[model samples]
Target: MRPNIVLFGDSITEQSFRYGGWGASLADAYSRKADVLVRGYGGYNTRWALFLLHHLFPLDSKKPPVATTIFFGANDAALLGRTSERQHVPIEEYKENLGKIVNHLKECSPTMLIVLITPPPIDEEGRMEYARATYGEKAMTSPERTNEVAGVYARGCVELARELDLRSINLWSKMQETDGWQKKYLSDGLHLTPEGNAVVFREVARVFCEAWLSAAEMPYDFPHHSEIDGKNPEKAFQQKCL
Candidate 1:
């Protein structure tokens, strides 16, 4: 049976299969060996995610995900009292929500591996421009999110990983350490550019490889009917897997 790899999160994840995004990269890397499922909801946060988590991710799927990555917090870190309160989740609750999700997944699938991703940094200036253009200058003062504000959530994610003894990738910190990170990685201070996506794909691939070395190198199931002897296609396919 084919293993499943799940990408779960908000808009960033929703766009993960975009041109050079991580989903596509992972799909290409794990072709045939596993099914890469992307279930990203745009503009979602931890609260909304928890409310709908069970509905979105059924525990009883016959082919449960072998690996799952939870990449949220970008929206959860939205300014608390601003108009963006809809997406805002307190840091403590965010931690609780993440732990609950992890526990739920473990309960459902003991063998499933979990990886948590800290939200990437946001460039306030770029976000300000985006807000002005999108919401009009008079409607908004500052963009609802900032790198400093989001860092709290990122820290919570990192801490949870340690507490749970799970691998947590610090995308937030990693992006900022690079030169010109704001321009190179984020398109409008919030979302990932092609370069940012590549980084995510690489890091995720690295984690997956370390966790499941054999699975990472599984051979592609190939040599279809045209290549196989018409009378011996079944045997040929079996040999390929072996």
Candidate 2:
């Protein structure tokens, strides 16, 4: 039987409009060993996710998923400097919210793996320019002026996860390593494009597959497809369609 994975994140993960999200790609990549559940919402932060977790995740006797991979930080990192209740959650609150999520998930399913993902870095000029074109200069100014402010919050997530002993994927650094990663993977300087979704899916897949193999104490052998031993460019491209 295939293991089940729940993708819990923000706009980047929910952006199916840009060509579907990584969850779809993951479904295809792990067709033989796992299934994916996409529970992403745009403009949502970790705090909101924690608030909605009870409704979104019911880890009762219904055979809860085997793992939950969390990808947040985009919306949380948005420092619009607005007074609106939703504009942003204070950094301290953000930490508390994550703590709640980690503690809750650990108790609900002691055996289920929980993976936290750092937010990807945004292209300052590019995103701001796009925002200006879409929402006018007023909205773009904040994004343009700030440099790596959100990245700080993303880094905080890494620290928070480590303190809590949660498994985490450093998306911030990963995105930086890829050539033109932002341009190719991002639909808007802030949201992920189809290509970007593929990148995320591949990384998640590799980690998941490796974890599964490790737990089973067996070597991974794709005799028919020697190209994918937890890494391959074609696999990322192929996952885009799923």
Candidate 3:
């Protein structure tokens, strides 16, 4: 029987399918190996996902899934106008929301492996422009905060993954290594375009395949380890592990 895998996340996750996003690519890549399901929802935060899990994905013995991947922390950083009742949630609260998701999912399947991906960074130039255009006065007042808000939430996600002992895909660092990723991969500073989704989809596939192969005591293909070299336990272990 094919294993069931669920791709769960926020806008980036949502975009994966809409504009030829990674989720669609992943479902294609894993079609022969597993049953992949893309459950992407735009404009959601970690807290929102937790709520959705209870409402949309409650424990159902009749439809058990083998794996789930969570990619949140984008909108969790959204700011309210100074006059609004709810300001951007603090980073600590973001962490708490992540913990709650992890804890509840664990109750459903204690041994189910969960993968958490860190949100990619936004282009500073794009962000500054957004602030200037949307909140002209407020942007001038808190330009620094406006620029650094996403980083705060992204780091919070990284720390949360560490605390939970979950595997994390560091898209934030990976995106930095590429040139013009904002223009190339994303439709906007926040939402990924089709090409951008392809990059992320391949990455998640690599991690998922690695994790699955590791669990099954199977060797990873290609550069992850030498194909023709003698068995090297240390190198194999390192290659398979994050």
Q: Which candidate is the best by TM-score?
A: 1
Alpha-carbon runs more than 4 Å astray in model 1: 213-216, 223-235
lDDT of 1 by residue, 1-242 (tens): 77889999999999999999989999888877788999898999988889877776678867678899999999999997776888898899999999988988887789888999999999999888887888785656867898898898999999999999998889999888899999899998899999999999988988888887344567656765577888767877777765
Q: Give the winner by lDDT: 1 or 2.
A: 1
Clashes of 2: 1
For 58-144, candidate 3 gives per-residue lDDT tens digits of 765445567788887766666665431142566788889878887777877776778888777666566566667888866634322
Q: Rate the local accuracy (lDDT) of all candidates.
A: 0.87, 0.69, 0.68
Q: Tens digits of per-residue lDDT for model 2 on 120-145? A: 87877777678778877456344531
Compute the lDDT for candidate 3: 0.68
How close is every model to the real structure, measured as TM-score?
Answer: 0.92, 0.78, 0.74
Model 1: number of backbone collisions: 0
Candidate 1 whole-model C-alpha lDDT, 0 to 1: 0.87
Which portions of model 2 miss their true places by more than 4 Å? 16-20, 80-85, 136-139, 144-147, 213-242
